[model samples]
Target: MAPEPTSPVAGEQQDRSGETQDPATYEITKPLDEESPLLSPTRDEEQEGLIEDGSVHHDRDETSETKPLWYMILLTISIGGLQLAWAVELSNGSPYLLSLGLSKSLMALVWIAGPLTGTIVQPYVGILSDNCRSSWGKRTPFMIAGSAATIISLLALAWVREIVGGFLGLCGVDRESEGVKVTIIVVAVLFVYVLDVAINTVQAGIRAFILDCCPSHQQEAANSMASRVLGVGNIIGYVAGNIDLPKHLWFFGNTQFKVLCVIASLALGSTVALSIGTVRERDASLEGPPPKGRGGLIAFFKQVFKSIRRLPPQTRKVCEVQFFAWVGFFPQLFYSSSYIGDIYVQPFLEANPNMTPEEIDKLYEKATRVGTFALLIYAITSLATNVFLPFLIAPSYDSPANASLRAQRGQHTRLSRFLDHLVIPWLTLRRAWLIAHLIFATCMFSTLFVRSVGGATALIGIVGVSWALTLWAPFAIISAEISKLEEVRRLRASSPDDNNNNNTTDQAGIVLGIHNMSVSSPQIFATVGSSIIFKFLQKPRGTPGDHSIAVVLAAGGLSTLVAAFLTSRIQDEVEIPEGVVVEEGLAAFGVLSS
Candidate 1:
């Protein structure tokens, strides 16, 4: 049987030629009221209206499905390698200059550069991917290209270090001198930063891909799958780093590291393959073909500004929270290792002044292993919280199918409602999760006050506990929110006469770009700020200086708390009608476009 139209939209509509047309036109600009993400149009305009029409039993067709468990594991392992490498770089590179004997001042420059690039790179790439049109498809091309670029960049970085050493050997420069090695190190670090941007661009694209392919109800599983894969990557990368491959293998030096990078590359490639192979997808027929206009660099910037200006208020609020959230997240991700190294390794070295170089290296290795152990715990906790916790929280545990059915009907009362009999308490719990996330940020800020190796290690280790909670809760909440937003948009678009005006994918990508900025911006601030405190300010020159580093970390943590409060406003924003006036006063300096 043919699907009926949502309204009388199919009977008489004009074509692009401006004549009374035969086919229904898809205009997507309608405001979605009380929308839900689980709902999607079956086809283009005609199919969309059919789903919207009450004539058919649309709810039967709108039910959610889950990806197989094995597929989730496989996909996670393939993708996790890159994150492992990322963790290594973040942890090791934070104190990279110190390891290379560069003065703290010079090392600061490298740290400052890492997150600065992220601030500029991730959002634009995310937005572009949303609008891209090609034979290969939107995201795959970016994924393939980004993976290839990341591989080349990593190889260049490893080789660059070797080249510097060889050059110093030829020039008769003191092999161990700070300047000779520092220059070489800085160059390599810069290259790594550039490559990292490319890799993250691919990562952001992959994230958007999740939002694109997975329907609203499946977002939790999708996000869980992503987190699991990240854990797999971390395990592989850390295990590889822990092993002294160079001592036993022929290519243990630069070659061994190169091989590991290659493994990461392959792993990232595998993620692309799995996504392409396993997930069903559809083209955004609404965007039409890619436009013919080719803008110059200046024109591109102009377009970016224009795009930013036109974003709706709810979209803008998401961006604001992200901006604040990333300000905390990035620094922690990129600098945690370095912070650990500085606080623990450097202090131990000073205490045992006569310790051999090999001993110092050994101690550093031990600390790293400890950190990795903490990370493993964190990953397990994240998986448990995100993957398993939701399953238990539904209306009741009669059977999985019945529970899911109850959730869909919104008739089944869950634990929160049963206990409190009020929505406010449940909402407060959600608010508290964000508050805890901010409090965790404060723990990061407290690092500036830490002076002893034990203190630093203990704090960093405890961080895993809070981290598990934050990652699980926020991700679960955000996934649900996005689903709600998508549903609302789809419903509005379902209006029989509504023109497909607002670019759904593009708008979504823009919001995600802003969201990722929360992840990226903090890296920029943390690296640059820490560099100033550790290097230029010369605070860590002694015990007193070490305390200064802790202070900086504490400030960042406090900022996280503030962000948690701000996240509450976003919850309210989510309930507002789409394209409506976003509540004012919450607006930041940037003007929000309608």
Candidate 2:
């Protein structure tokens, strides 16, 4: 529903000296407490028709502070650097498990734990941060804690096997005993569990911080920068994972896993420190009355549920769009390497039916490398797209000098503005999905007849366009829309008896939580579904003439086609009727404008 029409906008303000001050020249030296971290005290044209229609006229102050571009750049690099380390942790997981003789099924359980922990933990953390009034700011403490956990988990993961072995020897158990094997299994699972929880915390903290601090207009830029960084991280991680570490200072002569874990610790720890240190926030608290919700864990879950119930229409729609989007994506992320590797090796297996298990493992390793190389190409393509596309595709805007012109024009309002923003980006996102899905579909089916490293690389690189959008766009849309409501709430806050606006802003954490719910819900399915297909359908490594790997890949391609269809059908923006401004004055809002 469209928000209630507001009273006429007040012009000019009364000065402390009993003079009438021009609205354009007004300054807000003091902050608006309980307002958004992203909201500037001064009003601008962009805020005028935020929904592309009428809204409460904000304080007419032009003296607003702006964040520097370098701040955003440093934030992205730090996150990207952390991703580089985190991705190494991810890429190394399966290999580390195999080295310890853990089964493929155990590896599947490990992967499933990530999405599970993410779905459960991130929302609670987001809610906690929203109401937190710590001196360092809401998000920084979480980021620091999560990073600390990541470092500890990595070091623990690296040395736990040896630590257990030494403990067993101390207890008079033989080093060659089965009890030692059970100890490795126990420690590995526990460490992986901690690592998963910690990583999710880091991602949630950083993401919320970005939304809290970045201006609505610049959100697309920030998200795209992060996406680009994610791509870079993937490349770095894969390369690092592939290296054979020389037997040096690895814990108890650790394998490649030790090298990766140490690198993960240093890279993630330093980057997280740098990121939290670089950005200064509104000094530790929002300068307003605390939100109206009852405090504590019960209120926390209640608020999350209530917020999910009351999400603005567009946020819900985006979640639906993403339900389909990730259905195709997570599968590819989980299984593309193994699927493609099996396909590439099918012919050799057909010719050498009786190959030894060692020889077969060698062949599969070579195939896996091909898959990794293709992923590198995908990462590079996504990076290039993320860096360059937004500016190239962005709309012409009113300059700072003409801050009020857009609002004054009255051409678009309310739902129209929402729709305008939605339509273009919606179309762009769907088009990317369509093109990428087509490419994916083509590659998947094509593999049945002929498989080549070049073909696999090309296919993934093409899909990277959609992948980049997936990483950036939904959050972009959610932030952009909710920020408008925030603008409405901020103005209303200045008006006594306007409790509804406060309620709207209270929805922030829950809405973001539901958005994550949508993200993880699909992963749960993909993890289970992909695991079934990979384990049951695909042939065991080194065995035999053929397997269902190509068939499974082709099925995922078809799923993407369906995902594209779902995306294309969404109506991207809200609808707002043209509003009639009845009057303008202090009494218009039952209170005087500043």
Q: Rate the local accuracy (lDDT) of all candidates.
A: 0.52, 0.60
TM-score, predicted candidate 2 vs. hidden true structure: 0.77
RMSD of 1: 8.5
Q: Which stretches of candidate 1 lie over 4 Å from their true place?
A: 1-79, 165-183, 239-263, 283-287, 291-294, 307-315, 346-351, 355-366, 388-429, 445-455, 465-505, 536-545, 572-594
User: How well is each residue in 249-350 modelled by candidate 1, as lDDT tens digits?
Assistant: 545243445555655666667666776566533444333444344656675555555655544444555555556665566555555554555555665656
lDDT by residue for model 2 (58-160), tens: 1232111234667667666657766765665545566456556665555666677777887778888877776677767777888888888987887788787
Question: Model 1, residue 364: what's the lDDT?
Answer: 60
**lDDT score, candidate 2:** 0.60
Q: Residue-pair clashes per candidate, as listed?
A: 37, 13
RMSD of 2: 8.0
Q: Count residue pairs with overlapping backbones in model 2.
A: 13
